[model samples]
Structures are given as structure tokens and as C-alpha cells.
Target: MDIRLDDLTHPAIHALLEEHMAGMRALSPPECVFALDLDKLRHPSISFWSAWDGDTLTGCGALRELDAGHGEIKSMRTPNALRRRGAGKAILQHIIGVARARGYQRLSLETGAPAGFAAAHALYLGAGFVETGPFGDYQEDPFSRFYTLAL
Candidate 1:
């Protein structure tokens, strides 16, 4: 799979992001859904990436700058039809590598605490991210599970 920085303009990326947003909303309460829309992910502090296997868009993820030493993982999603194919892990590792290269001391992420997000939890934990308290603009939320990896 090829993973690289994406400009967030491709029709496939937009469709994938839209599907991600819909899935998040379906799995969590509206207030607990932190998935960013394309506009929000396009912020200057955020770097988005798309994972592809030749012509197929496998998945996508993003990293948002929280500060000079920290970065937040955002918008990690693989289509329902494509789960468990390693795209999730690949994109996550890619983000971690980029964060470390940027001199970040830590990489953090917020995901749902619900059972529907079990795969995500496994992926993060398998990649060495441990459960932690809220970071960045997040407050304590029962519906959210926070994880951080010390780089």
C-alpha cells in the first residue's frame, strides 16, 4: 500500500471522509462524534493522508498539531467493506512515523468507547498506544477513549 500526504481534493477521499462521518455518527451520540469534516481537516495545522493500493483508496487518517511537542491523531477510518486488511494499521504507523520525524514527543488520539470501535481500539493498542486522559481541546467524556504514545 502507498501512503502519502493528501490534498483532500480527490473525489474518492471526499467520499471516504463522508462515509467516515456517517459511520461515526451512527456509532456514537452526536455530541461524542469528533470526526472532522473535510473543511475542518483542511486546517493549516493538520496534515491528512490517504492510503492506496494502486487504484483503490484503502483508508485515510490525519494528524493535527496540538503543540510543538505533541500531535493528535484524527479521522482514522477504513471502509466497512475493507476492515481488517491492514490499512488501518498502515495509516496509523505512517502517522506515528511522521509525528516522530516532526520532533513530536507524543502522539495522542481520541476514539469511541463503544463496542463498535473495537477494531480501532485493538489497532491503537497493538501499535503501543496506551489509554490516557483527555488531551488538547477534549474534556472528560465517557463516550471517548483517549490513547497516547510517547515518542
Candidate 2:
């Protein structure tokens, strides 16, 4: 798969993000949903990437610089058509690699706590993220689970 920074204007990226946001809404309430919309993802502090298998959009993920050495993972999503095919893994590994290269000392994320999010929680653990207190503007919330990794 080819992974590279993407412009949200790309139709496939928009469709993929819409699918992801819809899934989050169905699985969790708006307050608990950490998914970012196109405007948020386009922030200057965030670097977003899209994974493609030839011409097909496979998955996408982003890293947001919070400080000199702190970063956050945002909008990680692999389409249903690409689930179980290692697309999520590829996107995550790329994000981790990028974080390390950019001198980030840690990477953190927030995911839903609903049963429908169990697979995603497991995937993050498998990728070496560990549960932690909330970061950034986040607070202790039963609806969300936070994880962090030291780089």
C-alpha cells in the first residue's frame, strides 16, 4: 500500500472519513466520539495521510503535533472493504514511524469505550499503546478510553 499526505478534497478520502464518522456515531454518542471532521483534520498542526492500494483508498490516519515532543493520533480508519487485510496496521505503523522521525517523545489517542469498539481497543493494544489518563483538552470520561506510547 502507498501512504502519503492527502488533501481532504480527494473524493475517496471524504467518503472514507464519512464512513468512519458514521460508524463512530452509531457506536458512540457525539460527546464520546473523537473522530474529526474535514475542517478539524486540516488544521495546521495535523499531518494526515491516506493509504492506497494502487488506485483504491485503503485507509487513513493522522498525527497532530501538540508540543515539541508530544503528538496525538487522530482519524484512524480502514474501510469495511479493507478490514482484516492489514490496512489499519499499515496506517498505524506509518504514523508511529512518522512520529518517531519527527522527534515526538510520545503518541496518544482517544477511542470509544462501547462494545462495538472492542476490536479497535484490541488493535491499539496490539500495536503497543497502553491505557492512560486523558491528554490535551480531554478529561476523565466513562465514554472514552485513552492510550499513550512513549517513543
Candidate 3:
């Protein structure tokens, strides 16, 4: 699989992001769903990427600079058919690499606390992220679990 920066305009990437947002909405309350929409993902501080296997889109992920020394992971998603195929892991590892290259000292993310998020929790944990309290603009929310990795 090859991963590269994405402009978020490709039909496949658009559809994937829509599916990701839909899944988030189904798993968490509207207010608790923090997944970024396409517009938000286009922010200057954010770097979005898509993973592909030749002509097929496998997954996507993004990194957003929160401060000079910190960054946040956003919009990570892999299709059901691609789950456990290393697509998500590749995108995550790519994001971590970019964060490190940007001189970030820490990388953080916020995911849902529901059972549906177990796989996500495991993925982050396996990638060396540790459970932590809210960071950046986030506040205490029982429905959210935060994780951070010190680079």
C-alpha cells in the first residue's frame, strides 16, 4: 500500500470521509462526535493523507498541528472490507512520522469510549499511545477517551 497527501477532493476519499462521519454519528451522540468534516480537514494546520493499493483507496488519516510541539490525529478511517489489513496501521504510522518530522514532541487523539471503539483503542495502544485526560481545547467528557504518545 502507498500513502500520500490527499487534497480531499477525490470521489473515493470524499466517500470514505462521509462513511467515517456517519459511523461516528451512529456510535456517539451528535455533540460527542468529534470527527472532522471535509471542510475542517482542509484547514491550513491539518495534513490529510489517503492510503491506496494501486487504483483502490484503502484508508485515510490526518494530523493537525495544535501547537509548535504538539499535534492531534484526526479523521482516521479504514473501510469494513479493509479492516485488519494494515491499511489503518499504515496511515497511522505515516501520521506519526509526519508529526515527528514537523518537530512535534507529542501526538494526541480523542476517540469514543463506546464498545464500538474497542478496535480503535487497541490500534492506538498498540502504536504506543497511552490513555490520557483531555488535551488541547477538549474538556472532560465521559463519552470520550484521549490518548497521547510522546515522540
Candidate 4:
């Protein structure tokens, strides 16, 4: 698989993001949902990527710069067809590499804390992220679980 910077408008990427947002909405209450809309991910501080296998988009992920030494992971999603096929791992490794290259010392992410998100929580933990308190604009919320890793 190849991972590269991408415009969020890429149809495949957009579809994957939409699915992820839908999952978030379904799994959490409206007020507790914090999925970034496309507009938010398009901000200057965010860098998005799409992972592909030849002509097929396998997954996507993004890193949002929080400061000179910190970043946040966002919009990480693997296509349904590509789930459990190493797509998510590839995208995550790419995100970590990019964050390191960008001089970020730490990376934080917010994900659902419910049973529905167990796989995601496990994935993050296996990737070296540890449970953490809120970062950035986030506050304590029963609907969310936060994780952080030192890059």
C-alpha cells in the first residue's frame, strides 16, 4: 500500500470519512459526537492522507497540528472492504511517520469509549498510544476516550 497526502475532496476519501462520521453519530449522542466535518479537516493546520493499493483507496487518516510540538489524529478510517486487511495499520504508521517528520513530540486522539469502539481502542493501544486525559479543546465526556503517544 502507498500512503500520500491528498485533497479531502477525493471521492473515495470523502466516502470513507462520511462512513466514519456516520458511525460516530450512531454510536454516540449528538452532543457527545465530535467527528470533524470535512470543513474542519480542510483547515491549514491539518494534513490529510489517503492510502491506496494501486487504483483503490484502502483507507485514510489525518494529523492536525496543535502546536509546534503536538498534533492530533483525525479521520482515521479503513474502507469496509479493506477492514482487517492491514489498511488501518498502514494508515496509522503513515500518520506517525508524518507526525515525527513534522517535529511533533506527541500525538493525541479522541475516539468513542463504548463497546462499539473496542476494536479501535485496542488498535490504538497496540500502536503504542496510552489512555490520557483530554487534550486541545476537549473536556471530560463519558462518550469519549482519549489516547496519547510520545513520538
TM-scores, all candidates, are 0.98, 0.96, 0.98, 0.96
Candidate 4 residue-wise lDDT, 1-151, digit = tens: 9988988878777788889899899999999888888999999999988889998998888899999999999988887667888988888988999889989999999999899898889899999999999999999999999999998
Error of 2 at 52 (Å): 0.6
Predicted candidate 1 versus true structure: per-residue lDDT over 35-81, tens digit per residue: 99999999999999999999899999999999999999999988788
| RMSD (Å) of each candidate, 1 decimal | 0.7, 0.9, 0.7, 1.0
RMSD in angstroms between candidate 4 and the native structure over all alpha carbons: 1.0
Q: List the residue pairs that clash in candidate 3.
A: none
lDDT of 3 at 87: 96
Q: Decide which is better by TM-score, 2 or 4.
A: 2
Candidate 3 lDDT, 68-141, residue by residue in tens = 99999999999877799999999999999999999999999999999999999999999999999999889878
Better of 3 and 4 by lDDT: 3
Kindly report which residue pairs in candidate 4 clash with one another: none
In Å, residue 126's CA in model 1 sits off its true spot by 0.3
Off by over 4 Å in 4: none
Candidate 4 has a TM-score of 0.96
Write candidate 2's Cα lDDT for 26-144 as tens digits: 98878878899999999999999999999999999999999999999999999987788888889999999999999999999998988988878988999999999999999888889
Error of 4 at 19 (Å): 0.8
Off by over 4 Å in 2: none
Local distance difference test values of all predictions, in order: 0.94, 0.92, 0.94, 0.90
